[model samples]
Target: MAPVSVVMVGIGGYGAEYVAALDRLPLEKIRLTGAVEPFPTRSCAEPGLSERQIPVFPSLEALFQAGCEADLVVIASPIHHHISQSMLALNHGCDVLCDKPLGASIQEASALIRAREASGHSVRIGYQWSYSEGIRSLKRDIQAGRFGGPIRMKSVCLWPRTLAYYRRNDWAGRLRDVTTGRWILDSPLNNALAHFLHNLFFLLGPAVGLSARPLEVTAEVCRVNSIESFDTVACRARASGDVEVLFYGSHATQDSYGPRFELEFEEAIVAYKTPVGDVKDEISIEADGRRVGIYPSPNAGDHFAKLTEAVRAVTGNEPVECGPEAAAAQTLCMNGVHESISEIPTVSSTLRRRSVQPDRYWIDGLDGDLRRCYERGVLPSEAGVSWAIKGQTIDLVNYDHFPTSENHA
Candidate 1:
């Protein structure tokens, strides 16, 4: 059989990893048909892209219009372009492996879903942890009801971001595109640390490819950074059956921490506690004081499982473990987050501090505060913080579009 033809869009940043994965595969298994990168020369893609003599195009349309076809298109582009680019790929009769949180809004996810169905193509979202062997092993147990009923789950990710990180492109930390006015909604929970938040929902998914629907959400959103969206957020979403999922994420930290989590069930508890100052997200499930299972950090060598799984699904006509439907749960959670808060709160001037090495403003002592909320499985309002404002409880049942119209009652 001929190699599965591939075209990778967005070759810089995380896209570099996808290129590396492609390079690792034998050319006979998956061929690099072309790349869609406006700045192929500046991207940090592994060297020898030119030596490989692979073609590169500035945009997806240009690649397809050049009469170049592909079996799969791996998209690592920004949040705003996810829907348009993905629908284009599916319409062209190509499968897609789009990066995580699927698209910018729940509406986009639905649109992509329609496009995939119309084209009879598959769409896989890049929530890599869901594809990891360890996570999959754990999900199987949870799905089989071995853990009894899930009680509640909480996750915390306090990664610090320099000013340059948000300034990287036009959409970084933005809620909407300034020029195009499209929903971007880039934030800590939506972008950098999104995988961990998505993992909770994915693990609780009704099926391997379908995440549990969030019935309602209550969230606190605040910003220490001067971005349209908040830099820090703590949200509690109630899934069907009254199961609770709590998340705490912030870029307003002086030091990097967490992605740590604790999930409680009727019979036992599973948890991962990475020490402070460590970047690796190695996952191990502990129950009843014993380490039940262990797997390498999702960031370890095996995360390419997402890519490999998508490729196999496209070529073999098998089911993808995590698809757009499953990933849409995270997007819904994020959308609810923005909608819950009528207005974002800014930290008090006395508590805001700035760092200069790379230049960023952080809310002093915020890491510990968010950690406390995670430890207790509560949001700031529930924890009785003085400045906390309890956001409106958004009914996510039948919640379809975002920036919900005033007629929504």
Candidate 2:
């Protein structure tokens, strides 16, 4: 068959990583045909694109207007543009591979589901962990009853960010785009550490296909930074099969723990822990009184590799491993988190604040407090913080019954 043609939207930052991954693939399998980047000469200019001689367009609309056709469209654009861009690509008779946090709001997510059903084109979300070989192996073990069914699952991460990180773009830490008036919940649970949360849901059951859906969620969202969204969050959700899921993440710490996910089964415990900000890690399983480590093969964590697989699946008219249905649980959990809190409460002045650098602030003792929460497998309130507020519970058994309003707006 001819090489599958791909057009990328966005070519800077994370987009550049995609370009490097695509470059490593065999040219006869997939080829880059075009890009949508308004400032190609700026930070977005990538050597891979220049070397491949891919044409650049100012926007997706511009590329479509030029009558350029592609077999697949990969969108690495901002969080707020995902749904619109994915719909545009599907309308043009192209399958889509969009970045995570499928949509900024539940309403937008529902709309994308509707569009995909109407277009009959495959749509995949960029949740790299869901595509990792190590994760897949773990799923197989769970399905084979190696662990004798999961009892509970926990995902914890403590990643710190400087104020400049939020300043990278106008939408970095915003809840709503002032220019487009669209909802953009750029928070820890939704954007930065979303993969960990999504992976927790993916591990419950139905391992080979779409992940288990969320049934309910109770969460507490707090903020110490000046951003519109919360920097610290703790959530407990119930998934299909009566499995309980716990998530605790924060961007307000002085120390970083990277990301760790643990699943406790009736007979064994499966865990994956990595250095801060690293996704490529091995899984350790303790079953039948024996411990074993499973290492991922080369390029197992390469998101571009997963994207290429999705493209191949679409070309072959096969089902993608991480499609729209697999990602719906994430959207429901995120929306439920926001619904749990009417407004984000700020930390009390008792928490010491130190000026790390110009425009950057760090909360003293926050790292230890967060670690305590993880060790105890509880939320901040349950961890004995005087200022912590109890979270609200939400039932998502009837997902469509949840409110679709822009909570932050």
Candidate 3:
């Protein structure tokens, strides 16, 4: 069989990682035929693109207009471009691998689902942690009732970001992109630590191996940093079967803690903790009176390698893991978080902002406060902070009614 022809959209930063991964794969398996990058002058300098001599287009629309053929489209563009780019790829008769969050809002996610279904092409969201071998094993054990049915799950992370991180792009740390009219709610829960939240729902699978659907969501989101969107968030969502899912995430701390999750079942508790600032760390599972490390430490290669395998599965007409439907839960919850924004009152006085560098401020006590919330399995409000406000509950069924005036670009 001929190698799969791939057109990558955006070849900068994370996108370049995809390019490098594709270059490492056997030439006969998959090849980078083309790329869509708005700033080709900057992107062309990337080693992968320059070395491969891959043709670069100004945009996806331009690529399709020129009758460029591709078997798959890998979208590593900004949060605003995900749905539109994915739909464009599918419309052009190519399968899609989109970056995380799937879409900025549930409405956008639903539209992508419609497009993928109409096109009859597979669409996979790039929540790479979902493809981890250890996570897959945990899913299998959950389905097999090894833990005797999940009761509750919690995901927590406290990774700090410098001011430079937000200043890198126009959309970073923004609630909405005024220029594009795109909903870029680049908050901790939705962007940086999103995989941890997605994993919580992924583990509570309603079907044998699919991500669990969120029935309802209640959350408290706040901004400690001088950003439009929330940097710290605590949420409680009820998944299928009345299983409670808790999430605590922050990007305004002095400490950097990688994502970790705990699933409690009737029979036992299952938990996995990765090293700080790395998701690919060796995962040690604790359950049933014993603890054991599973899978070798993951490297940068694991993510794109698995993505390549997913593309192969699509070509062979096999089930592609972590497809759009599996990602809908995260999108739904993300929308819920946005909807609850109005209800979340501002938090002040509790956070002492100390300058870590020239312009970056880290919340001095945020690390300990967040750790308390995770340990006690409570929201910031429940953790007894004076400035914290109680979370507001939102029903997932009302997802379509979410304010779209601020969401559309």
Candidate 4:
């Protein structure tokens, strides 16, 4: 077998991960064809494309126009650029591994699905956790009916972002891209902490490569930061089969805690990063009122499995574990969330505390409160938080298309 020629879109930010992975992969099995980055920064200078003599183009369109033959194209571009680039790659008879939250809306995701079908090529979404054998093992058990009827599942993550973090890119804290006016919806729910949010639906997926659809979403969204979009959110979604999914994500905190989750099933309760010291990082399961120790975990840290799986999928004609249809669930919930809370509120000034070093602000007691909500299986509104705002519910059944308007104001 010959080496699979690969092209990468977006070589800065998270694109650096793909670059390093490509470098680490065996050269005989993987050949670097080119890259698409209008501005190649020094951040990706180490063992860099320049040193490797890998050709870098200004855009994916340019690469394809130059007839850069590639079997696979890895996209780590801005959220707004995903659909366009993936469609181009597919049109050029190349497989795609576009990055996560597939796009800002379910409609965009559907278009990519259509493109994949039309092109007769593999199109994988880069949700690394979905490619993990550990998570796959967990999902298998759930699908096998070992966990019994689903009750409820909730996840909480409070990762603090500094001023510079938001300032690094134009889309960081935005509800839409500034220049392109495309729906970005870059927030903790959709961006940094999306793995946990998407995991809930992915695990509950009836099949190996699908996710539970969010039928309706209710959410409270606010920001303490100096950004256009909300940095904190508490969302409750009613998925298919009457399963409840709750997600609490916030970047407006100093205390960094959790990407933790607790999933309740009739026969057992499963948790990740639970308060239990002995099994903090493992997928801990408690069945029939007794706790079972952690199972042999999946090597989730080997995120390059996303790329490797995509390579295997195309070269070996294997099914992609996470495709456009599977990734659309997260986009659906995100679209409904924005519609549910069109008016993003500002967290109470009195409750927010400012910090130095990077000029960030945080809601006092928020991290602890979110952790408490996770343990208690409740939303922040139900937990009686002083600054919590109740939001409307938006139905998402047969939901498609996200109106590109300033609704998040």
Candidate 5:
């Protein structure tokens, strides 16, 4: 097929990384047409990247007007602008690959999903960890019955953020209301906790539907640098299958231990020790009481690289890795976590099918979910998983590990 023409919507932190990933794809399969950053000065105005000559525009509208037609749009913009930008891209017949969290709110995310469905274009969210060589190797092993069936899973995602971190960006800890214009990021649930929530569903596949409300969650949220948002969060939750999952994310510490993912079974412990960044692409499975290290691919490409492939899939008329079900399930999981904290109980009922459209922005329902969870102790689980419908734990066990590392703040 002709190389899938694509554009990077944002040229900031993740945006820069996305550009790097796009550079790694086969030149024939991918083409870097251009980029759209509202703030050309702010996006790639820096010294080094500017000289690369990848044509940076000041607005999405401007990019479209420049007669630059592309098959896909890769968004690395802030959480605040994800939905709007993605919607516009889809409207223009461009597929989208948004950064994780889908949107700052459920409604916005739902709206973006709706737009994708309406446009009949593919939309893939960025959760590069899922595309990791480590994850792929473990997936191969799991499918091959290497460490038996997945008995349990655990993750210690210590992503530290100092006071300066939030202060650095205006939208860092914001609760935005697109209609009325109100925003705040008062806790770790949305920003930091979001990473883990997305990965949980990523590693486990979308076989399990996520309940809109958190079933059970007990978290100790703390504020370290006087930021309005919680710097540290440690909580445990039970999702659609009554599957107990643990979550801990923080923005208070000076140093972060990075994100660590592990899956345990009766046979052995399969773990992926992920430090922050694009390095370390080895998957190690400790089965039969011994650690067997396997290197799947050294080129654990960044989000842009995988996103390029997704775009190619879109133009080529193939399925997407970050499809609707996966995106919705992930957003649902995030809602569950936030609701669990605020006491909003959610039930996953497949019987209730709603069109994937964002009539309401996500942040709008945060307070409501929290209040409901507190009022109703029993959260409704999505009725699909036989393991969940049967009310049986499915013989899965989980362990939470957060040892004190030298990088602790």
Candidate 6:
């Protein structure tokens, strides 16, 4: 109601984007109370926030003590800090709007879910694609049977990350192991492809839960440069969702064709292939050997704007579409791809939908040592390895990238 009180964590890069969204929104409806950054020296010394008037607290607790009673805690923190920061915020009675890939692993994500349930507060994962006007229109059309009885889904995501991209930040390839004080890639799936997978389910609805499972997955991990993690991952997932669904995504390419999402159904083909800009939500559907086109009504908000609405829903005691449960399901799908990649069994096995096992391979050491490092929340270099995860592992990887100075310059 009264301008959802808000505190933001990590005000650099993506965090800065949230800051701008908060500023652009009705300031009277959402207030930026305070912010938290561990490196106050770097943050304060940086010229980006020179004009920002809000006080910058060095710790989460410090902000709370300073009377920052926020109804919303928007975590734009690093991928690793997302879970911990979200837990702290919910525990402190603040509703949360988290960046995508809520946690590195489903295990970590479960902890956040437990916290939210215990606190009885709302939590929204930042899968803004599900909220996009274009996506919503497509979903509506599909439900209306505009595409006919059976539907097939196809997701194409091809983007290039140059060697310079990884060299730009020390944390780029560095794994954060909270266990054994070591860094590992145990959570790569979430950090990399959570949104892409989740958007599929959001559009289609309970895909894996029903009659079909991901029968087989063929993945190709390409190392375009020195980044420990795969700079480009192309996967072809074959599943039985109503008819059959073939999905593909590749994050390595100089020539990217479309907006990273498209769907082909039994009747017609619907696509969203423009760059990241405003576009009319239009779909071409064919049924019974007849073709039809539909245009979506106009809406004022983009992804972040939809996120603000979710925050309001949480504050108003309403259920969130992208809540923890949905997030966990998304995480499960993400881990499925990771597990498939790791356990590249010479023989493929058929299992029920949503099957996840405890993965220590993602940790270093055959034993619990790497898990211990991850639980301790130490950076990768401290864990005696450059990067470690189940399906992929690399040693002595280079973290040199464009300097922060250059990024700002």
Best by lDDT: 1
lDDT at 392, model 3: 62
lDDT (10s digit) by residue, model 3, range 36-76:
88776666336557676777888999888988879889998
Please identify model 4 stretches exceeding 4 Å from their true place: 274-280, 298-301, 404-409
Q: Considering lDDT, which of the candidate structures 1 and 2 is the better prediction for this target?
A: 1
| Tens-place lDDT digits, model 2, residues 197-311 | 8888877758566778889899987777888998888898998778889998988887778588778889888877774356445677777768765546312556565687776
Worst lDDT 10-window in candidate 3: 292-301
Q: Give Cα distance to truth, residue 340, candidate 6, Å.
A: 2.1
Q: What are the TM-scores, per candidate, against the unseen true structure?
A: 0.94, 0.91, 0.91, 0.95, 0.69, 0.70
Q: What is the lDDT of candidate 6?
A: 0.54
Cα lDDT, model 5, residue 367: 27
- Each model's Cα RMSD: 2.3, 3.0, 3.1, 2.3, 13.4, 13.8
> Model 6, 1-409: lDDT tens per residue?
4777788888766777777777777767776778887764454323444456777887787888887778889887767678888999988988888888766555677788789889988778887765666666666666677676445555444443344545544556444443443333422345555566666656665431111234444443333334455443433444445443333333333334333444667666665444346655444444455645644422225758555775567546554666666665455444444444543221111210111231101111212322233234322234553232223321101211112123357
Error of 1 at 389 (Å): 2.2
Model 4 C-alpha lDDT versus the unseen true structure: 0.83
Model 3, residue 110: C-alpha shift (Å): 1.2
Worst 10 residues of 1 by lDDT: 275-284
The 0-to-1 C-alpha lDDT of every candidate, in the order given, reads: 0.85, 0.80, 0.77, 0.83, 0.55, 0.54
Which numbered prediction scores highest in TM-score against the true structure? 4
Model 1, span 1-409: residue lDDT tens: 8889999999999899899998888878898889998888878773567877788898999999999879999999988888899999998999999987687789888888888889998999888888777777778888899779999988898898889888888788888899888889999888988998899898898777888888899999788888888888899999987999999899988887877878788877877777445634566666777767665655556778888887787669688778888999999989998889989888789888997886989987787788888888888878776557889999999899987873275
| lDDT over C-alpha atoms for residue 340 of model 2 | 84
Model 2 poorest ten-residue lDDT run: 400-409
After superposition of all CA atoms, the RMSD between model 6 and the true structure is 13.8
Q: Model 4 over residues 1-409: C-alpha lDDT tens digits?
A: 9999999898888888888888888888889889988788645543478887877888998898888889999999888889889999999999999988687877778888898899999998888878877788888899999879888988888899988888887788887777877778888888888777899999899997899988998998788888887899889999877999999899987788877877899889987773445654567789878887554343346878888888877779687779988888888888888888758888777888987876888988888888887778777888998777778888888667785343234
